[model samples]
Target: MNLKLIKGMRIVAATHNPGKVPEIAALLGEDYEILTAGQLNLPEPDETETTFTGNAMLKARHAAEQSGEVALADDSGMSVAVLDGAPGIFSARWAGPGKDFAVAMKKVEDRLEEIGATDRAAWFTSALAVAWPGGPCVVVEGVVHGRLTFPPRGDRGFGYDPIFIPEGGALTFGEMEPAAKEAISHRTRAFAKLRAALID
Candidate 1:
């Protein structure tokens, strides 16, 4: 689905993660100019929120206030049901302090096994927030259901993608092609909703 924003409307994507920048740019379409918080040297506030929406808003607000432009931010993570929804907001830092997704995935697997959870039903959640300076802010969410697999597979994607297999798929997200994965990823679902809201 293609959507167009007003020309000359610069939007800041409030993320320092290189992984997210291009995806946001692609989702926002060509009419809107996309900028990164790192490029603008925008300060990142501590994400003390307990929910993805709150964290997304916090980052988007920071970017909007700093750049004096509308900002879009997304917070996403994997939630394992057997683990009691652990590693939710802390998905990025689950591996102690750094953004070590491999370690985080191992920890998740260990925790699940510790509980003897054979029916590992889980879901990936993504929340996209857009803040327009002092103007209104909007938050949209989307989820993709899946189950966990032993011994992470493939070398594509980041985070728990290597271990999580989406429903009706043979390969884990890490094993799927980028275009194939993007078609049904949690972030893509959320961004699709956000695009509809913003453009229509």
Candidate 2:
């Protein structure tokens, strides 16, 4: 079966994270009806995979199989160059069971301090995957280079946004308006490929 998203299709978003819900819906735009695994009461699957694409594919497929519909999932994280990508796949876990990004951000900052890292070069990586029930999936990844900022700033976006300043940008993702952030977000960059392959 050809897996494609129609103009008014209903599909599971394969995520339970509140912050990710709106972001995914916004990134996918209004053409499609986006439902969440949480909304459907589908249990969030364990992300056992080590890579973004691997985890994304697992989530998407599980959601698709359970929901009996097309499913899309995103696995993303921030990696510090100096930290040797310390929090790469464990981004969410870094936030702990409470999922408090504030604590997670502090952990990152403390790690940087521990190493006396002067170069704050960092990057955000996003993996987007779409799967059809009992069918194959398509996955794509996008990355945006940037550096870390101290003390965090703003409160617009979620997760590690406040501490990350995208390359060639003055404001952190948290400081930028939703539309502004979307214009240069790792999710947007990643979804562009999915749009080309399945939507458009």
TM-score of each: 0.93, 0.94
Q: Considering only N, C-alpha and C atoms within 3 Å, which residue pairs clash in candidate 2?
A: none
lDDT of 2 by residue, 138-185 (tens): 999989999999899999989999999999998999899988887878
How many clashes (backbone N, Cα, C below 3 Å) per candidate?
0, 0
**Candidate 1 displacement at residue 155 in angstroms:** 0.2
* lDDT top scorer: 2
lDDT of each: 0.86, 0.90
Which lDDT tens digits does candidate 1 get at residues 1-200?
Answer: 22334667788889877666667778766777788898888888899899999999988888888889888888999888878888888888886677777899999988987887888788999999988877678899999999999799999988889999999998999999999999999988998898788775
Which residue runs of candidate 2 sit more than 4 Å off their true CA positions? 18-21
Per-residue lDDT, model 1, residue 55, is 95
Displacement of residue 26 (Cα, Å) in model 2 is 2.7
